[model samples]
Target: MSAKYGSGGWATVAIAQSVGATGALIAELGWGVTGPQRVPRLSAVDKSILYRQSVSSRATVVAFAVLPVSVITWLLCDFSRISAIVISLGSLCLAFSPAWFFIGDGKPGQLLAYESLPRLVFVGIAALLIHYDFPIGWYGGALIVGSVTALSLSAICSHLGFFHWKQNWRTIRSQKEVVLGRAISGSFTSFAPALVGLVNPLAVPVFAAVDRLMRMALAILAGIPNRLQSWLGAATGRDRHLRSLMSIRYNCYLGLVSGLIFGLLAPTFVTVLFAGQVSFGYELSALSGFLLFLICTSRGFGLAMVAAGRAKHITISVLCAAGVGVPLLCVLGLYFGAVGALAGQILAETVGIVIQSRILSMKWKSNRQWSTYAASVLQS
Candidate 1:
């Protein structure tokens, strides 16, 4: 695509992706981080209710949110207006997806069938379309088709009574702090990358492509750590602390090995996959992979904080990173282009990991001290 349409097409896709990611973040609303904290503590019935409410609430917000974003994106990307609209539609479908229900239930099979399969179908269709020299917008349509199918299946599952729906606006309202906090944090987390694209609009494709590749590497390697963090969140007392430390250690080792492998393979991967149009970011990809490793290693502690209801601390940490990272990205991107953007992102993630680790360490030390003090008093 970059070869055919040049940087403009890639920029369009990148912008659409940014808009879509924002929608996903709005839908996520810390659920990815906080769901584990709540799921294990709730009864099965309560979990079902929570899932339905979450889906409904998020869907409602996304419907309203996506419209303005889509319009703004379409206006901004005059070169790819239809493509932007298609991407926004697909994003809206994703926002309303019920895959979270399966995730909360620990039904990986259903999640795969309902979430993964449709996406695979979309990929196949998109490949065929592109092979036949169809319009780029057709790719977006394929995504929407697949997403609609997945959503239809989710609706069927809900109709079959797999989930319980309860209208609890009061309860939903009560979680406003968490939902808004996570939304703000997530927005900032995404802002740096998007800002790079906006700043160096011509380099959008290169930056976005490299970021996507690095993210894929992180996704593949970080899965285990991600699940571990979930389990850590569900653990209690000494068990929680023990598991947290163990998870961090295990992921650090895993991340080192994975980062090494990714860094070694990334140059070759870019050469083959992007046919060298994006070779500029080959080294950046490797660097980003290592940074991703750091982020994944620290994730368990972050989850533990969320589990302990320390969302404010997490939010503050992210805000600080964004405040520093965004301007750095713009400055670097203006001067160094995509590589500078990548550098800025690494700086941001590093700051985030450092702050989060420090906060978690302090919390852990405080807890240990209190535990020892209580034990001494009991002994006396």
Candidate 2:
């Protein structure tokens, strides 16, 4: 895209994706975060019910969200307004994804069938179109086609026909706390590209390009915690605690190694991915690597906390991180450009990881003290 449309056009696409991500989150209403935590213990019937409710709730939000998201993309994009809107729509349509359902159910086949495969086919089609010199806007159109197909496949597979909008709305309202927490937590990262666009529009090409790469890495790394959620959640008492500890340790090591590789390889990868149309330096790569490390490590702690029913702590940690990170990102971006902005991201992620680690420590201490008390009482 950068080769064909230039950096400005690619930057517009990146910002559109960023905005669309936030819209998708809003449409999800925190279900994406909470669904995996609950789905493990549900029966087939109960899981079906949960899926219906999620679709209904998200559908309600999407109805209201689409217009605003399109408007935002139109306002934000400096190039190719139509492409931006199409990409944003595609991103918003992901609200219908059944990925959390399959992940929680341990059904990789279903996940691939219902979500991944359809998208993969459309992405291939998109590549062909791009190669043939179709308008870049068609790439976004392909995304829309892909997402809708995936959603249709999911609906067909599940046989979910009815959605009680009223009942689902009530359920959505009941989960306001979790939804709000997720929204606040997601605000900074999801909107970071738009924020950069606001301050340094020219720098957005470089920053958004790097941010897009980091997001892909983060998604790949996310498989770790997604796997661990089921592993740790399915265990009991002391076993669960032990699993959580192991999960965190494993993620920490992976985070360190991945961060190193990311720092070393990002410059080359970005250049290669963009066909050398856009690129960044080692310094930016290093900062992005540091940010990735903090996030990857903390994901383990966050998921463990969720499994332990300490989700409130995760919310608090995210709140603190966003509160500090957003402003710092904007201020640093204003003065130091992309480098300063990346530094701010590193700081914010660091703050979040510190708070999360502390909370886990406190929980461990509390658990140990309670175990000791119970043992003494039994002995007496």
Candidate 3:
């Protein structure tokens, strides 16, 4: 897509992506962390009820959140407005997805079927369209078609007892804090990229392309560890402190190795993949790969924190990172364009991971102390 559309076309696509991502962030509302943490404690019956409530609540919130943004994007970018709206609407499927249920249940296959399959189909259709030279503007519509198909399949599966959903407003209300934390954290993360688009129009495509590719790569590498964390959290009859420590240690090791390997390879991959159209992407991809490693190392700790009821800490860390990072983004973008923006991202991630790691360490120590005290009391 970047190759065919050039920077201008990719810029439009980037705008659409930002809109969709923003909606997803709002829809997720911190459930990515909180759901996994809380779901295990509920009965199967209650899980179904919560799932339905969560989906409905998030979907409703996303609809309201996306509408104004769509309108604003429409007013601001005449050419890409329709595409942006279509893409953003398609992202609503993410809210309805049963991955959270599957993850909570320790069912990876179900998560893959409900979440990954539709995305794979979307990719196939997109590649076919792009190969045949379909109009670039229509590509966003393709995303909608794919997402709807995924939603329909998921719905069918849920009906057949492969997944669960049972509406309950009260349960949804009970999760208000998680929802708020998710929205705030997501907003801080999403704001930086959107700001990049506004500050440097030309850089949007380059930055977006690299970011997208790096994210795809990281998802593939990080999927297993991510699933494992949820499973470990939900596991019973085990030393949770030991599990948490082991998970963090191994995850960091894996992330460090993966980051280094990908960082070395990303430049070559970018050069070949985009046909040199996005030459600047090589450096950005390298930086992004390193950042991905840092993120990977922190993922276990972050999930552990959430499982320990530290979602607020995660949100605070993200906000602090954004506070420090956004100004740097604007300054770097103004002075050095895309490269500077990429540098700003790296800086921000570094700050975020440091803050997060510190908090996680504190939480771990607290958990250990409390565990020792409880053990002594039981013995006495």
Best by lDDT: 2
Task: Give the alpha carbon lDDT tens digit for every residue of 48-72 in model 2.
Answer: 7888788788888888989999999
Evaluated at residue 326, the lDDT of candidate 1 is 73
Query: Model 2: which ten-residue window has the lowest total lDDT?
Result: 157-166
Better of 1 and 3 by TM-score: 1
Clash count for candidate 3 is 1
Pairs that clash in candidate 2: none
Candidate 1 lDDT, tens digit per residue, 54-151?
Answer: 66666666667767777767765757688777765665556655554555555667767876788888868876776677667776777778766766
Q: Give a tens-digit lDDT track for model 3, residues 1-380.
A: 76776666666666666666766766665666677656777877767666656666766666677677677556545455676566556654456556666776777787677668767777678767876887554566666676566556655775523323344345456566666555554443444456677787767767776676666777687666657656666654336666766777888888788877777777777677776766553466667777777777767677666655576677667777677767878789767776787677667777777887788778777877887999999999
- Candidate RMSDs in order: 2.8, 1.9, 3.1
Largest TM-score belongs to which candidate? 2
> Residue 230 CA error for candidate 3 (Å)?
2.9
Clashes (candidate 1):
0
Query: Which 10 consecutive residues of model 3 have the lowest summed lDDT?
Result: 160-169
* Full candidate order by lDDT, most accurate first: 2, 1, 3
